[model samples]
Target: MNFLSQDKSSSRPNKAIIILSLWVFAILLLGFTFRTSLDEMITVWINVEEYSHGFFIPVITVYFLWLRRHELKFIEEFKHSLPGLVIVFIGLILLILGGLATLKTVEQYAFIITLTGMFTIAFGLPGLRVGAIPLLFLIFMVPFPQFILNNLSSKLQLISSWLGVEFIRACNIMVYLEGNVIDLGIYKLQVVDACSGLRYLFPLASLSFLCAYLFKGPFWQKVLIFFSSAPLTIFMNSLRIGIIGIMVDNWGTEMAEGFLHDFEGWIIFLICMGLLFIEMWLFSRLSGRKVAFNELVLIPTEWSGDTKQGNPDIRFNKSVFLLMLLLIGAAIASHNIEGRKDLIPSRKAFLNFPLQLGKWEGRNDYLNQYYLDVLKLTDYVIINYTQPESGNHINFYSAYYQSQREGVSVHSPKSCIPGDGWQITQFGQRDFPDFKVDGNALIINRAIIQKGDSKQLVYYWFQQRGRTITNEYLVKWYLFYDSITMNRTDGSLIRLITSVKAGENIEAADQRLQAFIKDLIPVLPAYLPGKNS
Candidate 1:
């Protein structure tokens, strides 16, 4: 009887150790499975200023876990859950789909999903309840997709420029605002992508969320605290621009350049963070209440480690075996996926494109080296076509990508048009049933954009595989679908721009573009490959 009891007593710690080892193995397997995405995210942290905060997010997450360690006491037992298994399967599907699509954003999100699913599988609802915040907080490290970043940067530039102009005007300084450019008589301040405040917003938003998690206050106050980061960053960033303008007007452009300019960003971020704390204090005092910094932070009570070690009832659950197998399978599958190369289709070079098409006489134009480096297009053609009869001219441009993976893909005209000091007055898609490409009716995105007294009519569409895409989001979907089903991700952006004469209406410009498209359509197939090509 005594020998049997000793054997059973020795087995308890062995069971616990096996469970701990399996947990560690599962985590390592996840890291191996998602290594590509993790590497990509780390690269963004190192290279991209906007996402530099990615490096610290993991550390912060660990701190949050430590803060909530005492709550793990509630996790007395873990059992097999069918719902969790379903989630795990869904996560696995997403990982495969994302891999097949060659989408880093999707893969990054899959990491979060799989982690959630596995956590549930291992510990069930009780553990998830305690650890949800820390786990979800890791999302801040994943960078936004390039298209979203571009769209957001463009919008923020305009907002910052407009508000900065307002601040300058309030100071009784002469200023003119056009798109994202601020004109101050002798000085012109262009609010480039770097000045878009994303560098500040991303980090501040992450910090705000963490602060909200720790804030000991009403739920509404915590919600307000988390949501305030964006406006706070934008308003302060704009103020910094305004201050730079003021300094420039008085101290010349030197104040807005070199080390001091970079220093200003850090200063603005600190000020914004300080303001958040002040807001918290003001909220605490609003209803005749007071809370100190220490009080504001909800600290989890730490107990002696006796409960953790003293409990002999804890035993390893068998769900971990399934988790182990799933993770290993995921790792092996991802390895094969990472090795797959994009399929590049054959097409005529853009340089071989004819200069003369129908009645329009085209003169080929070449972009500067800087633009070529920035665009990263595999092949492209740009030409200004003119009709000698009416002396009317139209700008025709098409950019093609042999593989739309990584950062190389179509740049939507909507995102770039406003960056060049144009305000889009009317932007929507129109069906040109009268116009056809390969007997298929064409649907194009038409826009009326203006800069000062100058106005232009622009039409654009994405030619993906064999389909014409109008919406930017839809293009992404097709990119993924085609990459998987058709083994093709090649696409092109075809755009036509024509001036809307001072006295003429939009119809006249439309007529000009109509003529150009009629001639251009016949020429596009040779360069932009379709399914048949």
Candidate 2:
């Protein structure tokens, strides 16, 4: 008698359960496969203020998917894309290569790529087309490499200091800018790492992406809104710095201390969010539309409902099954290979390095334990040499690594010097007129760094596998290359620094470093290996 009123859920075969089960299985496999990278990413999210937003990325991603759940309701049958197999395979290769290289950054990226491939595999191109934005939004969760972050922070500090100084001048307040330091007549304010705007940049950029997704606007307008977060953050942070400087100048040093400093940051961040909305309002008028302020960030018309719809039913196929096998196999294999050690190249230890080269008297120098832990170097040598004839002295230092597979690596002077209260005055590559390495003119990074009226000339480069490189970016590249081709990631950073006396010109300082290089290179190869070694 109740045949006409049968249960609809039972009739439909509970496709959602099947779909979720497949997702759970796949996600568990992914977790196991990338546990090392994922654990590190979580640690960064907890520890690094700049990337704290990473903890919320996945929750937001799931919310986005929930918003588009209506679209999934209408898909007649989930399709497995045969072509996605290639992408999944490629992701595995990247994982293997990254794991072997011990590049956690690369391994983290590979996790995203693998998930992308899995998405493509599970639902095919049509599903991919629908879910692309939510998937790609996960990118904000990954943190940049430490060196890159330091370099970026250093650059932003200088920019902010310059802008803050300009604001002081605009206010009829006198100020002198030295590197990242703003010298107010009464007080000196240094634009250190904390003031670099990175804390605002990452979070605001992530917020902009979410806002852009929900924004009802033209395609170009959405892109503009997203990319503008970086500049907007920089401008607002500079404004905050300038305001603090002016306040300190007029009021007192108390204006820049305690809860007031933190309050200023919060106010600046709120203003940044408000400015984004204002930008949308202005953009609407320019486009000849009167968009309501509240409506500016409303979900687009397209997301309201789906058209050309069909019923969704889970369908398992060969491609998806093969993907499961690959995931399981790779995860188990990686677990076994996780403990394998790096192949360190043979070389003389730095402890045995000669203190005296030629015509130069030397004194051995050592870094404190705190620096030694932070740097995580395998071996190093630090010496100060003086030529008695000219009373000239040079500071020579080199840090070596047996296996720079993960976080341990060289620290570039370009980034580290700024943190040590030294501001870079000049930075560029220079070739020696009298020195050569492997038949080519030796090139090094030349920089004039100053702190509080004291000036120093510095020369530095990276010696890796067999090549000498001046650029920090290239050092990372060759590190990966040699890791793959030569099974070696060993390298050393060579640096020579000399002071510029009150009456001495920079040329004299440069000559002192160059002469030291000539005497140093011949002795370096014994400690730092050549290409063949």
Candidate 3:
């Protein structure tokens, strides 16, 4: 009997080794296959401040898994699952589509799904149930797509600016709020993207998730702890802005720059963490339980109680083997498909675009080098056209990209205008029955934006592959659709802006843009690539 027990104990290590080996092989294979996606995620982690916390997510996930190792090992049996293979197949399909579209966001999500499928296949359902939270936590590593980030940042900037101004006003300081700029008598504070609270929000939210998971509390309390991060971050960020404003007012403008500014941001983030802890403590008190702070906040040492000691039965899952074969086949097919480049139609460069359109004469303008780098446009044109008779000048801007597969696509003016201190007060689509391009009526987004007392009439549309899209969501949909159907993701944004002068009716501004659009319609195909071109 002693000899039999010794033999069983010896087999346990062998089982562990086999399981570890399979996991390592699967992970290494996934890493090799999704190398580009991983590189892109790492690039964002290193460069983008808001998502820098992504660097620690993988380590945290592994730590969580390690903590649950005992529980996973005690499972009664490991069985091959058909459902796991089905999930793996779906993940491979997503990988193939994401690869063909060159969408890093899609590919990154697919990588997570594929990893989950592998885990489910290797560990079986019971093991997965034990480690589910850690697997789900991996999602925090992926940075949001640029469009969503832009919109969120813009909204946060506006909210922080408003709250900061109100706080200053309560302190008896004379302050004026215009969009995202706080105008204080001698100095102005612009709530740029960095101050939008996202830098604090993402990391703090991740921390809150960790805190919620570890907090030994009721379900409702855990949820409350997780949801509180947003408001806490926003409030703390606004408080920081108000403090900066007060310091600048008393100590001069130097208080708002360099080390002091960044130090304040760090301080605010720390305060947010403290607030979350305070929330957890409050919940503990309300629940009629006195839990120690260390117990509530520390990493869990154990996931589950130990089970009977025995050598659990284990077998190689043929379904997982078949799934691996399918993955290998899909990887080869994706590599070949991605290697083929899309067809780029020839078109006239923006430089050769006509400077004179009917009665209007134009002078070209150039964007700053920093702006050009940020935009990453393949080609662009910016011109101020004036009707010499009416002295009505309109700014015409167009940005063209040869391909948008790599995520550098057109940014909507709706997302960008507020960043420059302009607030969009009115927005809707306008149809020009008289204006025709290739026998189709013109439709464009018309927005009335204001800054201080100044107003401007803006018209913009996305021209892509013979489609004129006024809606931003439709543009995104078409980008995905065209990437799959036509193997083309080339597009351009055309914007026309005219100021509403003092005491001048907005109708005049509208008419001015309409007239310019009429003149600009026929000539756009020369520069913007379309089906006819």
Cα error, candidate 3, residue 393 (Å)? 1.4
TM-scores, all candidates, are 0.94, 0.90, 0.93
What is candidate 1's lDDT per residue for 263-298, written digit by digit as tens? 999999999999988888888887467888566656
lDDT of each: 0.84, 0.83, 0.84
Off by over 4 Å in 1: 1-11, 73-79, 302-314
Q: Compute the lDDT for candidate 1.
A: 0.84
TM-score of 1: 0.94
The residue-level lDDT of candidate 1 at 318 comes to 70
Candidate 3 Cα errors over 4 Å, as ranges? 1-19, 73-80, 298-304, 307-314, 437-440
RMSD of each: 2.3, 3.2, 2.6
Estimate, for each residue in 26-102, the C-alpha lDDT of model 2 and write its tens digit: 78888889998899999999999999889899898887777665565222233446656677778777888787777
- Model 2, backbone clash pairs (residues 3+ apart or across chains), number: 2
CA deviation > 4 Å runs, candidate 2: 1-19, 73-80, 301-311, 368-370, 419-423, 432-441, 450-455, 501-506
Clashing pairs in 3: none
Clash totals in order? 0, 2, 0
TM-score order, best first, reads 1, 3, 2
Instruction: Tell me the deviation in Å of residue 338 in model 2.
Output: 2.2
